[model samples]
Target chain A: MKDYIQKMQTGGDIVSAITAFVEESKKINEDNHYFTVITEAQAIEQAKNIQKQALTKKFPLAGLPFTVKDGICVQGVETTASSAILKGYKPVFNATAVQRMIDAGAIFIGKTVQDEFGFGALGITQGKGFQAPKHPDDPELCCGGSSSGGGGFTKKIPGAHASLGESTGGSIEAPAAFCGVVGLCPTYSRVSRYGLLDYGTSLDKIGPLTKTLPEAATILQVIAGHDKKDETSSQEPVPDYAASLGNIKGLRIAKIKEAFAEGVDESIKNSVHEKLTELEKQGATVREVSLPSLKEGIATYFTIALSEASTNLAKYCGMRYGQSGSMNTSFDEYFTKIRTHHMGEEAKRRVLIGTFARMAGYRDAFYNKALKVRTKIIQEYKQAFKACDVLSSPTMPILPPKQTEAHNLTPLQHLMCDVLTVGPNLAGLPHVSVPAGKAGIMFIADHFKEEELFRTHAE
Target chain B: MITQDVLDKVAKNARLTLTKEEAAQFLPQLDEVLTHFSTLQDVDTEGVEPSFLPVKLSTEMREDLPEECLTQEEALKNAQSKNGYIKGPKSV
Candidate 1:
């Protein structure tokens, strides 16, 4: 990683990185590791610029090589969101998170794959004209997504130290769990969302996926904090996250019983249980806690997610921007053709639910009620946190299903995989999903207390 | 109860075209989903304040100030089509 950084500092171009990445990616791609490898000369220019800043010690992320989910805007490069509608669309301004990383001296390695528009739990949801990519270790397995490419790149892209990905439900955690990496989903508004391509606005957050918790902490320190461009950004002072990594002795942790139930895969449950035992041995107090609200998390998550998604996606009419097609004489015809031609199955699915829930008669009955229920769910978590300083659970109920098996599962079944993740997202709490043994376990804390959570669980 | 027709309508409204076969497959699945959510109804939240953000926050109200924003040209560069105002597909 240091050599890669030095290479960039010494005027090494992105072409070299791209060449190395592509060669490495080809091997991984044969194992189904990635979807596409970005090869534009512009990446070289970006790397060189970042390198110059790094040499001056002006940037925290100087000389670091990173990948971003394809959904994020990187000026002059196609921000596909893994969708065909915006296949060649290139943004002129960077997403606030990407720009921040760039300003911190991080080199852009490439754009990684995602479920189209960061929509799905399983990584396979691609937009019109695209297909889901597979995993590096097993072609039949999934990489876990809407941040699949980012997760895949973290594992397979040679000399690539870390990557940025997004999460609505478990996009970051699921992939990290499957790929055996560290995924941090900061409290909502922890990172600015200025140029993020939306799927679910209220729940969406950009975060880092890295090999270790310390690296994640460092990356979060650099990319986090307020950006005026993003309405949802929090103005709170970004804490010294790296400085908080200390001894975990005497910390209180609660293991959610629902996350380790009979329905959970045996191997994953056992592995997580053993990790908790290790944490106990390390002087942390661990006890089982019941969170009945979590059982409803997936359903409530979808209600809120889809309702938000419906309105958020309305901006994609082909007449203004994005992919356009045959001219329609009527307004309805125009929308139908553009959306019909552009949106993938998953995007359409959520939009329909969202639109219906937000419709005139149904808004109060469905959308508002869902929000009320979401409030109640949040309350439950707040109450739970009173009993423990941090909450722990398996990131996913089971190991990632094979990509082929993923398509076979119903969408609701797929959503169930996020049962452990959605609660933290709904409550706007900070959480980190770290690799523990084979499966990943999530550690969640009250909002803005991510430092506390990370300090207690660093491995 | 989520029915096949409801599912189909939801799918269409969302702009997804699903075969009858797929609808049949998802109907029971969605029913199970809603059934699971029924668990939340048992929790009493009568007096609890709805938590919007986990952290207590007050929206920062700022005095109007000039700030750098992407030029209209730069913003429109990514737009599929543009006129004086950003153009989107006509909606009924």
Candidate 2:
């Protein structure tokens, strides 16, 4: 990350560099659907501002360009979260993360595409008028999502660039793993979600997807902190994350026993185990530990996430913001019309399931039961952390699959892709996914212990 | 398990109008999803208070201070609006 700022400081021609970057970005967006909107004009404008002020010496992220997940607001930029219902709705102000990154002098590149409302793992669930992004490596393979564009863009961007990725359940990690980049999700509330279109209020977190671990950390340092605009944002002291990359020696790595069983691909297992062995040889201790409640992770996470999401998405009725239909109808019919015509198939399905879980009679059975299970899941994580500083698992059970595979799965099966990533999410622990072998390996640290994740990942 | 009748009711409650094709495709899938998630009931969560957030939270209030804010024009920029208010569907 510092390399880009250094380059901008010494390389007298900033305008030419930015122009080439935009040209390359346009080509990549066309080839892979990596960006929903490439802010070429905005990027050039910001570049000119940097050149005029010579801000590289004053700002940490000066001259460093960053891409935002579509779910995040970027002032006048169209932030649709890849959903048709929100099409043409440009926020008047920046998301807190975007504002902070800009404050640190990161130039806005563009908004990246993802599953509508972050409801899918395969990147195939884009709303109407948006195409699911293809894997950067092989177009036939699916890009992991819902931060699919962030993952792909980070990998494709040559140097000193980062993408701000939001995760509710493994969105950042999945795409990063598939694209072979560093996807790090901070603890829930670690980064304010002020301008983000909500998915699940309790679970959503904004973090970074970068080509290198240190860049991820550097971006997090800029964005993670208290924001009064977001009530849930943490007040915990922000650490110097870029400077906190310490040796992993003596750190305990507790490998989850359940993550490697049954359905995981052998290639994925071999890669993570190889990393574990490498870490052990580098003086870190590794042990097999079981968090049995994790077996219920997918269930607990989806139930709570969807339940919260159902309510959060209720705000997108046609009149106040986003897509609108003719107003010659009753409120109910108008809402139904706008939603029916604009929302995507997967988005509608999620709302239905979420609404059902929180309805009367079923509320106690599904939503409430899931909430209790969430507590149990958190307890299990706490128990495991008692014996270990960091927990280890494969980021995903399967490698990035064929593009067609995303279409074949039932809704039940599709959500299973997030099984390994949800436990840490449910408990609000910090987790990072690093490129391992064919996929990426994930490590979870205790709440407020993002330093531990960076330290161990530095190895 | 979710039935068609339940789905229709839930969809309506959620302000969604599902087509016959959508309902047909999702009805069974939603049922199976709920059945799969029913496994969470097997765990003993008796007496466990639900954890809405993993971290402790307290209400954060800033001084009741006036600050420059979005203009009405800017606030209504994304919405269908006229005469300084967002236009909406007819309400009783």
Candidate 3:
């Protein structure tokens, strides 16, 4: 990313660069099916304006181009979150983060495909009619999701590009690990969620996926902060994220003991441990810490996320945006028809389960209990952070699985793929997944302390 | 405990129609996931407060000031409208 910026500073023609990029992306996007919509004309126009004014060095983002996950609204662009129900719907306003990116002069390239409504851990559950993005390393294997397409595109594209990815549970991290990119998911509400299609209202966060940690930090500097547009947006002051990009000499790393336990592949553990030792040579300390509530992460996460999702999704009836069906039937029946026809299998599954969980008789036992359990988990993490600067673990339990392997998994198996990631996500902590050896080693920092994630280096 | 009847009722409450095959296919799987969720019952959360959001956030109230907002055209762009208002199924 810095190299690309240097080129622009050295009088590289922004228009020419952006035009060539769009043409290159167009050729590659045809075969990969990662991009849902490439905003070539808009991007080139911005590039032309930037170059005409000779303003490359003036804007922090300069000529850098970034992709947005399908969920985040880019004004006048279809923001479906890859769900068929919202295929033709374009928002009137850019999401706060996207607006920030544009204001900082980052070129908007395209939208990438994702799991329907950010519902799946594996990329396979793209809303019916959308193709799931594959791992950049191999076409046959599935990229992790629900920021699946952005992860692959960020990894595959060369020279100074990033993707703005949103995460409910482990959407960004999982895909970053699988696609071998740096995915930095900020603490909940650290960035505004305004204009982002809601999944789990409280759990969703917007972050950047890039090839390098510094690039991720730079994007965070551009997007992270309070925005009145998102009521849930934090009132906390934004820190100098770029300033924190160096020197983890005294950093303390806490290895989540359970993360290395059974169900995790042995090679992943060794690789993550190896990365930890390498970080130690930079004078960082490592220690094992027990987070017992980690065992409850997956169940607790799905319970809360989907329950919120069901309510959030209720707004997508035939009367509003997205899909509309025959109005001849009663209102309820009409809505049922539109949703039944448009929502994918996973979407139906999540909504039904969410509805059942939030039902009167079961709400107390499932939804309420999950919330309390979440509190306990948060406390558990707080206790762990007391002894260490950040938590360490393999970003995914297993390496990126083949499309066939991902296809064969039952719903339960697919949900469990988020085992290592859901812990921090459920806690709403800031975390980043950096590819290390055979697996991605994820470093998680406490809520609103995203700068700490930058202090640790990848090299 | 999510029986076929419960699943149907849940689907109805959510305003989502599931074909008989979908219901048959989904019910057992939903039951399986819920069964796993049932394990949470064993966690001792005797008096723990629920964390609705992980961060402790206070209610933020904005002054009710009207500013330039989405124009009617923009607001109704995605809606199916008869005149200007969003169109809905017959209510009469």
Which model scores highest in lDDT? Answer: 3
**lDDT tens digits by residue: candidate 1, A231-292:** 67898898888777755888789998888888888888888888888888888899988888
Q: State the weakest 10-residue window (summed lDDT) of model 2 chain A.
A: A52-61
What lDDT does each candidate get? Answer: 0.75, 0.88, 0.89
lDDT, candidate 3, residue A70?
95
What does candidate 3 score on TM? 0.98
Estimated TM-score per prediction?
0.91, 0.98, 0.98
Q: At residue A62, what lDDT does model 1 achieve? A: 53
Greater TM-score among 1 and 2 belongs to 2
What is the C-alpha lDDT profile of model 3 across B1-92, one tens digit per residue?
67888987999999888888998899889988999988889999998999999998868799999988999889999988888898899765
Per-model DockQ against the true two-chain complex: 0.44, 0.83, 0.80
**Cand 2, B chain, TM:** 0.90
- Of 2 and 3, the candidate ahead on DockQ is 2
| Ranked candidates (lDDT, high to low) | 3, 2, 1
lDDT of 1 at B91: 55
Q: After TM-score superposition, what is the CA distance of residue A262 in candidate 1 from its true location, in Å?
A: 1.8
